[model samples]
Target: MEQFSTMFLSFIDTWGYVAVAVLMGLENACIPIPSELILGFAGYLISAGRMEFFHATVAGMIGGMVGSIVTYYVGSHGGRPFIDRYGKYFFMKKSHVDTAQRWFDKYGVKAVFFSRILPVVRTFISLPAGFARVNMKKFIIYTFLGSLPWTMFILYIGWLLGDNWKSMLAVGHEASLIVATLIVLICLFYFIRYKRNKKRL
Candidate 1:
């Protein structure tokens, strides 16, 4: 883990925005790169006067769009059978896929926009949107809107914390994980309740 972190930090230090873009893209593409780490480090750099926050956010947004586009294309072309076969390896299940599909169907492009602000949900939301054959232009626009704010917030937090940022980041990570887990549990509870209600009807 330390070696990987070192390599990742090296990549970010050397390549700057390009590394951020690729990392964000990969995070969206179901690779395990942490978008939090990328944005936070970028924020640290900005605080150190090494880069502009707006530019960092823009780079992150672009990376997010590109990564999501790749997933969308794969899901669109690969279809359900492919998702069912390969998704499990990535810790995704058919039920989760179906849930995302239903959300997209019910909410249209807004689902894409909102999901980008979520933690784990953000990673897989694009798959169902792609599979549902959502409008590409709308997907891009909503994704940017949703992701830009999130990217900016994390980066800004890092900038404000400066050299003491790592300690703040550790606290933030713990908080984010707790919040993400709670959201997942809440969503699951509601999904189960909705299913039971529908069955009775």
Candidate 2:
């Protein structure tokens, strides 16, 4: 954990917007880089008069699009077998993949937009959307729309808490754990509900 914080802080300090962009993009690629940390730190930077919130948000959005594009293509061309094989490498389970597909089927393009606001679910959502061959234009549009607001909201949190930047590493670690737990619980609940629905059918 100390090593991670050290590395992350070094990256943020040295690369600034570039670091934020790359981190956010990597997050989309299922690399476990939390958007919350990046946005929050960026917000803290803004409050410290180090960066503008608009620039930080835009950087995050662009990074997200690039990362999701990679996942989308992987889904579009890689097929189910490919996903099954590599899913674990990216911390994705087959059940999660299926759930994303179910949501995509049920909600169409809108799922792409809403999923961006979710935590762990967002990481795998684009893959199913790509697999389902959602309209490329619509997919990009919705993804941007959904992710942009989230990016801003998180950044705002950091901005509001700028005085605590020195201790952000610890705070971020705890916040991340909490958010991850919540996301897992949400997914579990939905998974059980879906299974019940399927059984009833």
Candidate 3:
């Protein structure tokens, strides 16, 4: 972990905003790279006057959108058949696809929006949304809205920590889990309400 962080930090240091975009894109593309580490360090640089916060945030957001669109396209273009045939190779199961589909069906495009704030879920939500062929305009809009606040929040946290931004590497994980749990609860509540309303109708 330490070694990877060091290398990632170095890459960001050398490439500036481009590195931020690329790394954030990879993370959103369902890669295991953590956004907290990326944006947190970028915040650290902002503190040191090495980078601007606005530019950094925009770069990260754009990268995330692009990456998500790519995945969404893949999912739209026969992602289900591919998964059915060879998902085992990558440890991706049909259940995963089903869950995402259910969420999209139940909550509509809002699932795409809410899922963007989640850690692991955010990385792959696009695929299912794509598979469902959710309206592309709404998908992109909600995706941008959802990612903006998250990017800013992490960047601000990093900036606040300044020289201590590295601490977020650990703290951010715990915080995200807490946030994710709360979101799940909220979604459950809405799901129940929707079911009740449907029955009444």
Best by TM-score: 3
User: What clash pairs does model 3 have?
Assistant: none
RMSD of 1: 8.6
Report RMSD for candidate 3: 6.1
Looking at model 1, the pairs that clash are none
- Tell me how candidate 1 scores on lDDT: 0.79
196: Cα error in model 2, Å: 41
Note each model's CA RMSD in angstroms.
Answer: 8.6, 8.7, 6.1
Model 3, range 10-50, lDDT digits (tens) per residue? 99999999999998988776666789999999999999999
- Ranked by TM-score, the better of candidates 1 and 2 is 2
lDDT of 1 by residue, 1-201 (tens): 568767877898899999989888988886766676778888889999988988898888889889999989989999878989998887566776777777777887789977776656677788888888889999888888767667877788789877766655466556355444655676799999999999999
Task: Pick out the ten consecutive residues of candidate 3 with the lowest summed lDDT.
Answer: 87-96
Q: Local error of candidate 3 at 91, Å?
A: 8.5
Q: What is the lDDT of residue 77 in candidate 3?
A: 90
